[model samples]
Target: MARTTKPLTNTEVKQAKPKDKVYTLSDGGGLQLRVKPNGSKFWLFDYHRPYTKQRTCLSFGSFPDISLADARHNRDTSRELLAKNIDPKEYRDEENRINEAAHSNTLEHIAEKWLEVKKANVSADHATDTWRSLELHIFPSLGKVPIHKITAIKTIDIINPIAAKGNLETVKRLCQRLNEIMVYAVNTGLIASNPLAGIGKANQNPIKKHLPTLKPEQLPALLKTLAFASIKTTTRCVIEWQLHTMVRPSEAAGAQWNEIDFENNVWDIPAERMKSKKPHKVPLSDQALNLLELMKPISSHSKYIFPSNSDIKKHTNSSTANMALKRMGFENKLVAHGLRSIASTTLNEEGFDPDVIEAALAHTGKNEVRNAYNRALYLERRKPMMQWWSDHIEKAATGNMSLAGQKGLKVVSQ
Candidate 1:
């Protein structure tokens, strides 16, 4: 006959003394208080593996840390697993592995990992702004949530209040960043799917405001003033290059020498630097080339065609040209970005192919397929159009706007 184990009391467990050999005080149901020869006491559950029928011991915890009642409860839980044909130790191990994965795959942890991968691809200022925005807004609310557990509804809850505060643009940007992070998480196997997909549809659209720009008649006076302005020669050249190319102010300010191909007469802005995330080819007009040659003496020593006067190692700030424009007393009348508007308006009215003008401006297509096709199709037409625009600007600036039949270019009153 098999013997039945007796239950132990709290007093018996506490008062149990260690002998020369380690021994256990049974609390029935496989629960035991193990007393070491050196006087250490621990609660352990002894059981047989369900399949192998082999005896195994699992520690509940130290005595007092795990009271007698708690040990019995742990023993009963393990027995339940055994009854279900599962090994208690294996079950515990699996639970611990799942918990470890959950702790490491929190939204904040995965966002940091995603940011590490992005830091190399984006500009330093952009990367810094992205991280700062996350820290200030998104992280405070969602950082501790497991990436897999975050839902679209929860994301909206966090961002909608920001939109309600009239920062819809910020909310839109935040949603974009979150979508990128979640997409990274999905690609990396941290999450099975992106929860923030289509999140922008939930955000309020920001009001669109066009930048203040010059009328056709105002261009000549603005150009004449810029020519005689007491600003730095580099600033004048930046403004001229921007006007000729119709590139964004940031693109012109951050221009690097290596991106310029004087041999091909092209300025190849890298995909990472461009807002469109695709390489842009700007066909340099002869006038644009002349401006470059004039700028070479002042900026040739630096990597940037328009290096910052305060820090030659870095490119000029995007605001330099705009500030120069402000100083020229065109603060509300015009902006650096307005150059693109004026160029686009004038070129469209001058009978240049709209696609060619768009290509010269480096405006991205509505989708990937169209963008790829536009970049290849409009290269040749953009070359001649660029030259004509340059010549037109010079003629207009010199007060000779009557281009009635010159090179098939026509001037229309605005």
Candidate 2:
């Protein structure tokens, strides 16, 4: 016959003195408190494996740390698991392993890994901006949260305040970063689905403020100011090139000497450097070529047309032209990017084809089919339009803003 054991109360267990040999005070149902000769008391649960019927003892914790009631509660949980034909110890070990994995695979951990892979694909400045955005906005609240626990509703709550504060653009960017990290997690088997998918529509639309630009009448005075400004010659040439080509400030700043083709009178910008991810051809007017010739003396030794002032080996910062404009008392009034708007507005008002104007501005089409067609058809007309624009600028600078050449231009299909 099996030996019968009596349950012990917490007070009786605490009052019992340690003996020469270790002895167990039973709480029934395989839960017991074992007191050692050194007076250390431990709680253990004895159970039989459902499959093999082998007995094993699983530690619940120490006495006082885990009270008699807590140990009984843990024992009941183990009994429930055993009733399902699962070994209690194995189930507990698996639970601990899952918890450990969740702790290690937090949102911040996955974001860092994602960023490390991303840094190699994007520009240094772009990668830096991404990192800074996470550090400032996303990391503080959700960084340590397990990726699986980050729900769409929770994410929207975190980002809605930023949107409410009138930083819809930042909220959009943060949502994009969260989406990327969550996708990375899913791909790596950290989660089942991305919670941040379609979160962008949840944000308020940012107020649109067109970039500040100079009017057609204001261009001549701005041109005159830039022409004789006491600034670096590279800076002056960069500003001139930006005005002539109407390319983005980054495109001009990162221009390489080899990208220029004096024979063909074009500048072929690689797709990687372009915002549209499509290769662009900038038709070089005679005036543009002349500006390049002037710039060669200053930056010819370096590969870039506008090499960095501090580090000649690298290209000049994209902000070089804007900073130059700011120092010329045009802060908030004229930005380097505003030159594109100036060109778009002036050329359109002058009756030039909008397609030609957009092509010259290197604006990408919204759809793939339209973009591919625009890339091929716009080049021919853009060459003549570019020359016309340069001549118009020259005439305007000489106080002849009324030159008539707007009647013969062909309008392309939209």
Worst 10-residue lDDT window, candidate 2: 405-414
Model 2, 268-317: lDDT tens per residue? 99887877667899999877887777777788999998899999899999
Q: Worst lDDT window (10 residues) for model 1?
A: 401-410
Best by TM-score: 2
Residue 194 of model 1 has an lDDT of 89
**CA lDDT of each candidate?**
0.84, 0.83
The prediction achieving the highest lDDT against the true structure is: 1
Model 2 regions more than 4 Å off = 1-4, 50-54, 113-124, 137-206, 399-414
- Model 2, residue 292: C-alpha shift (Å): 2.6
Per-model TM-score on C-alpha atoms: 0.77, 0.80
